[model samples]
Target: MHLLKIHGSGDARLDDYQRPEAGPNDVIVKMKNCGICGSDLTYIKIGGIPTPGTITALGHEGSGEIMEVGSAVDGINVGDRVIVNPMQTPSNIGSGGPEGAFTEELLVREARLGMSILPIPAGIPYEIAAMCEPLAVAMHGVNRAELKAGDKAVVFGCGPIGLGMVLWLVDRGIDVVALDLAAERRERALALGAQAALDPTQIDLRAELAKLHGEVPSYGRVGVGTDAFIDAAGAPNILSEVVAIAKYHSRMVITAAHMKPIEFPAGRMLTSEMTITTAMGYPTEMPDVIAAMPRLQDKIASMISHRLPLSQVLDGLKIAATPESCKVMINIDEE
Candidate 1:
């Protein structure tokens, strides 16, 4: 089978690998579409994710049809269209060390055993299904923030992950100010239903947030002030600002999954009585992540800004990294 293999740092190519035999709990799926993730950049630039041994395979975002199921598999059909829960594969090491979803086929457990959530339904397109994993990341960030209705959230970074975080919050009827330096992503966030898209470079969040919600009284928890602040850009020096922008009891959820050194202002952290929470990749979001598919059917498909065939995977990967496109997917059917 054809798959992406990283021979070394700054090296990745389409290579052939022996297909895995179906395990008792495993299911094999023919790939339809999979997304090029932001984190994949790290893998391509640096041979592997931080804290890792060496593995040949990579790619977790996948969606397609169930080709074959192990003898133990049941309650799923051979032709069911599906979206793979990226949580399917785990990082034996930390920070995406073992996450490799880009492939022509998928082997996963039938149940919640891993992050693989299947059966996306024929009505749903693989493009959107491929995003289930990231949306779940956004959802997890929202949950970690411990939100209540009418809460104000400032989502930093409007990339797919960041934009998805804003969408989930908006879907829950929360007020969100999406912060991003990219113009296209900001536009997509608004189109997908973010309350407001603010360019961090143009407008001052402190001024705007205060203007919108009265004086930035103190950040709140559950409700009041800026309840939740999620940073998806993984920028290095904004934790303190996030804390300062947030009300006193606010919770800051870091969802970038970025593996970089960041400065945390302990003095402010201690003074603000704030909470910092880190969301690892979909630790427990599989079931709901699957269930969320149909609910977000319309919004999901519309969220796609570009689609290309597998032959253009290289270009697609490049575009997905650029600010010009919100989400770029590859169709594996091209021969």
Candidate 2:
């Protein structure tokens, strides 16, 4: 088998490895697709997984077909199309773990029916099923916002995860206005059923949200009535901007990973009683995303902007790091 591994800083290579066999409670899967995440590039930039001189395989978001099932594993059979929950594995399958999904075949240790592996819901393609991980992350962020049906939301980015947030919100009948610096991303958000998409550089976001969602006045300050603000852009100014214009009791959820520390305007946020929270990985949202995939297939499928084979995964990483790409996937099995 071949796997993509990071040796040191800026050094990523596809190397040969021994094929893994299923253990008593394990399963071996023929990887079909793996999505390149922004963190993958970060892993390369910082020299390996955690330190300057370490080694680890390089993928997490993946979907595949079970090739060999352990005798002890029940209800999961060979040839089952499934998406992996990396976090549930004995060693988190990727992100510095002993195992990674960017390979010809993956060994899922102690595989459980719904915890370690989930069957891809029918009607969702492999490419889209590969997105279940990231979409789950996005859904976790949306869940943090605690949005209601009639509430309005403004997503501050339109990349893969951001667009996923838009799709999830729209599917639940929430009116959403997505903002991005790239026109193409804005268009993608619109195509995914966002009520409106705007380029933040060209318009006053506060005024624009007020127009779309209405305006509220409190403590002699006017704020947009948008109920939830999700910061998926990770821009330094986004936190302050949301604090400045958020309506009373509005919620702000930070889904993007920021490299540097951001200054929070605690004094300003107090005036509106605005709540700010952060979301990390998906905890219990993966199953929900998989369940929703069938109904939201078209919109979710549109999030993938590029696909490359496992042999060209290094090139795929470069494309994925650029703004021009939404979700760059490695078609490992050409399925």
Candidate 3:
């Protein structure tokens, strides 16, 4: 097997590696498409996630085809197209750890059967199927927000996850305002389905939010408030800003992976009765994401701005880190 293993900070190499033999109930899969998530970039730039020296192999947003099924593997077939739920891996290390799906071939044990491995419809492209993980994540965020139809949501970031939220919010008939610092991202957000994409720095966020309604309330509540506020940028001061802009009783969800403790303004939240919550990895989203695949394909595909073979993964990482890039897919089986 050939895998990209992280040795230390700023050190990852595609090297020949050994994979364990499949057990009676194990399945082996050949990697087809894998996405380089924001977390993957964070892991690379900051040594490792959680702590340095913890992660060995790094990549989890991946899709593949079963090449061989164990003798005891009954329900699964060798040719089935599948997505590996990295969360259910036996070691339970999460993505970007030693047991992730970054290799040419992966050995999946039965322990992960119904929980982690999901079979997608055959016609779905590997590139789109590779996005199942992130889409699921966005769905989880939406679920946490619990916004109703016709309510408005302000997504404070236009990265893959933020844009994904826009897709779902619009699909569900929730008006969406996508905010980002990048012009390209803002445009992409609008194209994907945001009612509007605004440069947060260019516009008065408070004023703009207030305008969403008729006008800023003259007393008590002063700004244009939103029903749901999502912070996906993980930028410094994002939490505080969202707290400030949040409307009374608005639901705010933090989907960004903040590396540090956030200092939220307790008074701001208390005054308006704003409910702030955090969402981690997706819990129940696969079915919905898969069901909406046809409608989401174009926008999801547009986010894949760059593709690279496993040999040039280092270069791919560089491209992925740039502001101009969106989702960067790595084709593992490219020869």
- Measured by lDDT, the strongest candidate is 2
Stretches > 4 Å off in candidate 2? none
Worst 10-residue lDDT window, candidate 3? 214-223
lDDT of 1: 0.70
Q: Evaluate model 3: give its TM-score.
A: 0.94
Tell me the lDDT of model 2 at 70. Answer: 86
Sort every candidate by TM-score, greatest first: 2, 3, 1
Candidate 2's displacement at residue 163, Å, is: 0.4
Model 2 quality (TM-score): 0.97
Give TM per candidate: 0.87, 0.97, 0.94
User: What Cα-based lDDT does every candidate model obtain?
Assistant: 0.70, 0.90, 0.80
Q: lDDT tens string, model 2, 1-335?
A: 78988888889898998866678999998999999988888888888866767888888999999999889999999899999999899878878777899998999999998998999987678889999999998999999999999899999999888999999999889999999988889999999999999989999888888889999997889899999999999999999999999999999999988989999889998779999999999999998998888888878778989989988898998898888789999999763
Off by over 4 Å in 3: 93-97, 111-113, 213-219
Over 130-204, each residue of candidate 3 has an lDDT whose tens digit, in order, gives: 998988899899889999899888898888898889988988999899999888888888888888899888988
lDDT of 3 at 138: 91
